[model samples]
Target: SDGQMPQTREHLLLARQVGVQHIVVFVNKVDTIDDPEMLELVEMEMRELLSTYGFDGDNVPVVMGSALCALEGREEEIGVKAIDKLLAAVDEYIPTPQRDLEKPFLMGVEDVFSISGRGTVVTGRVERGNLKKGDEVEIVGLNKTPLKTTVTGIEMFKKELDQAMAGDNCGILLRGIKRDDIKRGMVIAKTGTISAHTKFLASMYILTKEEGGRHSGFGEHYRPQLFIRTGDVTVVLTF
Candidate 1:
């Protein structure tokens, strides 16, 4: 909650790009506003802002509360029950999108490390499909050749598991690949999705001035961090 806020347009665009179907806004500090009319005004303003982002007011859940007071164990006045109600409503209203697991699995590697005698370990969020122990996987990148690997082990939330579905953040052990064969920001996909060469067409927006001048255009040199499947990669953006 303390992190830098994403710009409204950027946040909405990213949420849409990632296939998010609903947005929930938890507005803390209700206790700070003593006037009931002011609270209602704030809620209306939030709804209007979210509407501008294309989220239907009827679909999104917005809750107001005082998190700090609730943490101090002052439950009744701090409105902790409101928070719980919002969570329950979300559970009922928002359904998690099902991934096309039958499609070729592709994950973006976020981190890679050595696991002593067990060999290379890669951590990534599964972007698509379900990964199970003994499933053969391939590590591919725009700049390098594809490397073959087998899932020797899988873990979710620090517990070892036999399988992981899409949307799970997992650390996987690869039996045949070396640590040098893969890198953070490469992609792990089924063999057929692997493509060679750094050039590929993509749809992208000019994110920031720091990303370089506007008419400079998209090309191999503009490698923005791309989050796809369970993998995150630095991609050379091509128009």
Candidate 2:
């Protein structure tokens, strides 16, 4: 399934709750606003919204683009230029995490599905280390003993790849594992890197809404979807 785009403040908050250290905000529809001052005000509002969502306004990179116009292919030159600028900003600001290849590989499963003849296929962005075709990996948190399975297939960006490195999103085909054994929100790691826990401790600040009684209760249960790494889970919050 295609990943859902976050809409509300809570949705962005949920993204942060998952393990998103860096965020890129693309403010589309700049072509609609003809006034410069009005555009500045909109930009300010965007920054404020991001700050309210637990992001540093100065740190988080925001780009102005028109996705709709770009798709229509009317103003091709302007659209391509805007896209290039956005790509440059992303490359400059987002710091890619360094991975230790020698260390154990841990991939948090973000998506899972079944194939016609290939059986179960799992896809996730690799957080650390490297995984190669024909290599054996253990599925943690699902079973007690590490089930040794061969990497039947691997793909990166629609290209058939022999291996996947850290920070690269990949789809993998397993040999022995059944569809019932593999589940979304599970981590495929090298033996012992992932630890399963029933409870976790976290520090969170409640974002105040424009409407006054939104966050009135200090200890109310807040159940929001949590995305950590490539894993998505529902976290019950008490604040």
Clashing residue pairs in candidate 1 are: 107-231, 108-230, 108-231, 108-232, 125-230, 126-229, 126-230, 127-229, 127-230
Off by over 4 Å in 1: 1-6, 13-19, 75-79, 205-239
* Best by the TM-score measure: 1
Which lDDT tens digits does candidate 1 get at residues 110-214? 888998889888998888888888988888874456788889999888899999878888999998788788877788877677575545565655555432334
For model 1, where is the 10-residue window of minimal lDDT?
1-10
Instruction: Tell me model 2's lDDT, rounded to 2 decimals.
Output: 0.74
Listing every candidate in turn, what is its Cα RMSD in Å to the true structure after a full C-alpha superposition?
4.5, 5.5
> What do the candidate models score in CA lDDT, each in turn?
0.74, 0.74
